[model samples]
Target: MKIKVLIADDHQLFREGIANLLFSAENIEVIAQAQDGADAIEKAKHFKPDVILLDIAMPVMNGIEATKKLK
Candidate 1:
């Protein structure tokens, strides 16, 4: 089965670049993308991705805070 993934980053170009790279992988899928930590949490709850690629610094909320809330 393909591994579902969610990527969260404030940088649009970076996020899209990562998503594209993951999408090219046969065993992985880019399921969703988020602009910040809060958005990542919301998407995670809804999508329940197998993995999350998150940035440490972001607007609204940061990766560390988001990880705490998710856990």
Candidate 2:
């Protein structure tokens, strides 16, 4: 099965860039993208992605805090 992934970053260009790069990998599937940690949390919950690429610094909530909550 393909690996599902979710990317979270405050910068749209960076997020898109990463998504595009991952898309080039046939085994990786980009499931969703979030603009902030909180949004990432919600999307992660709903999407239940196999992997999450989170930025350490983000608005609304940071990656560290989001990781704690997600765990």
Q: 9 in model 2: Cα distance from truth in Å?
A: 0.1
TM-scores vs. true structure, each candidate = 0.97, 0.98
Over 4 Å off, model 2: none
Each model's lDDT: 0.97, 0.97
Following a full C-alpha superposition, what root-mean-square deviation does model 2 have from the true structure?
A: 0.5
- Compared with the true structure, the alpha-carbon lDDT of candidate 2 equals 0.97
Q: Write the per-residue lDDT of candidate 2 for residues 15-51, one digit (tens) a residue.
A: 9999999999999999999999999999999999999
Q: On a 0 to 100 scale, what is the lDDT of residue 21 in model 2?
A: 95
Model 1, position 70, has a per-residue lDDT of 91
Q: What is the C-alpha RMSD of each candidate to the true structure, in Å?
A: 0.5, 0.5
Candidate 1 — which pairs collide? Answer: none
